[model samples]
Target: MRTLIVSEFITLDGVVDSPGGGDHPHAGWTFKDVEFDEAAYEIKGREQEEAGCLLLGRQSYDEFAPVWPSMDEFAEYNAMPKYVVSSTLTDPEWTHTTVLRGLDEVAALKESDEPGTILVHASARLAQGLAAAGLVDRYHLLVFPVVLGSGKRLFSSDAAKTRFTLTEHAAYANGVQLTVLDVVR
Candidate 1:
């Protein structure tokens, strides 16, 4: 079975919104509030090296598809198999991209014999659904020090209680911390 890992750049108050500058009022909070540290983002490079595939929700897919393919930093992601969970997306323009209908497809993907991690990045709704369905096996969170107070959050209030064991952790000089946790199943 493959492991599903939800990786996110979150805030101190658990807000996962617009870390990379989107339509949110406090867009680009991740970069603006925290000092830049190369070591803090080492986990991102590690994730690209370790991940076998990438998964995203419709919103995230739409947001990333046009841009990430052109970014040299995301070449690894562009080369890997990308799965977008969407009911309406019929044709995907990105290379090596596949459209998954819903959570059932995600569950089936998890049941496959693939070895490396199925990394989920910035897909809040998909991550929440996967967590609600008990499908996420691990999480890689880069927690920043700022708190926006109001924005889209990674954890949903209606989700069932789940526990995780911290497998790896690191604190950078820039006040950004990296936390890797494995879901206790």
Candidate 2:
């Protein structure tokens, strides 16, 4: 089966809110105000290139649709195949995107013939749901140097019991740490 990977930018406390920008209550104290380096950008570019498709939650698709479409510079991501998980969303504004009606489609995609890498981005609720269903194969946690006492966590309360094997951990010069974990039995 194709591996389902979750690529998230989180804090030490596992809060994944607004590490990009914004003054959200839990995010205000968690993210560092800094830009990514050439290496980091290249790495992200590689990830985008390797990923055959992206799976997003409702909030993430809504959050990304407005901005990512206008970002002409990052054409790879904009052109990449996107599947969004949402129950209430009847119509999507983004091009080259399909809204997954339910969890069954999500499961079908996981079992599809394509040996594709599916990257689930900034979807706390969906990530939790995927984890509970045992669909996640790997968790790529980019733990930044910050902490919010309370916020939207990467692993929410509804998440199932999951354990990860530490496969790799590396420190970048840009103050971001990369933790590669394989969900194990």
Candidate 3:
């Protein structure tokens, strides 16, 4: 079975909204910090290389579809198979993109005999759902040293109280903390 991994750029208070600048008031909080080290990039590269597929929510899909396809850094990621869990996205313009409608599809994807990890990036709503449904196998949270007092958070009131086991942790020179945790299933 394939493992579902959630990768997020979050704040000190667990706000995972718009790390790459968006419509939010404090969108570019992550970019303000400039102290990241080579180790951070190494971790990111490892995750990218290990991913068999990319899973995204509608919001993240809309945000990334236009930008990633044209970027050289994301060439390999763009080439990887991608599935977006979106009810509203009727047409997907990105290559190798598929739209999945509900949690059952996600469960099926996880239960399949696919190799490598299924990575979910910056999809807070989808992450919550996956956590609630106990579909997420691991979480790699890159926690920035900033606090966005108001925004969409990673865990909501409706989210299930899921437990996790800390598998790895790393501190970057740029004050970023990479915490890798496994879902205690």
TM-score for all predictions? 0.98, 0.88, 0.95
- Model 3's alpha-carbon lDDT is 0.88
Write candidate 1's Cα lDDT for 112-178 as tens digits: 8886789999988889999999899999999999989988899998878888899999999988999
Ranking by TM-score: 1, 3, 2
lDDT of 3 by residue, 1-185 (tens): 89899998888998988787998887777776546466776667888889989999998999999999999988878999999998888889999999999999999998888877999999899999888888999999988888878888888977767788999998888888899999886
Candidate achieving the largest TM-score: 1
After superposition of all CA atoms, the RMSD between model 1 and the true structure is: 0.8
Residue 93, candidate 3: C-alpha displacement in angstroms:
0.6
Q: Write the per-residue lDDT of candidate 2 for residues 110-164, one digit (tens) a residue.
A: 8997756888988888888888788889988877777776667888865767788
Instruction: Looking at model 2, report the run of 10 residues with the lowest lDDT sum.
Output: 26-35
Off by over 4 Å in 3: none
Off by over 4 Å in 2: 26-42
Is candidate 2 or 3 superior in TM-score? 3
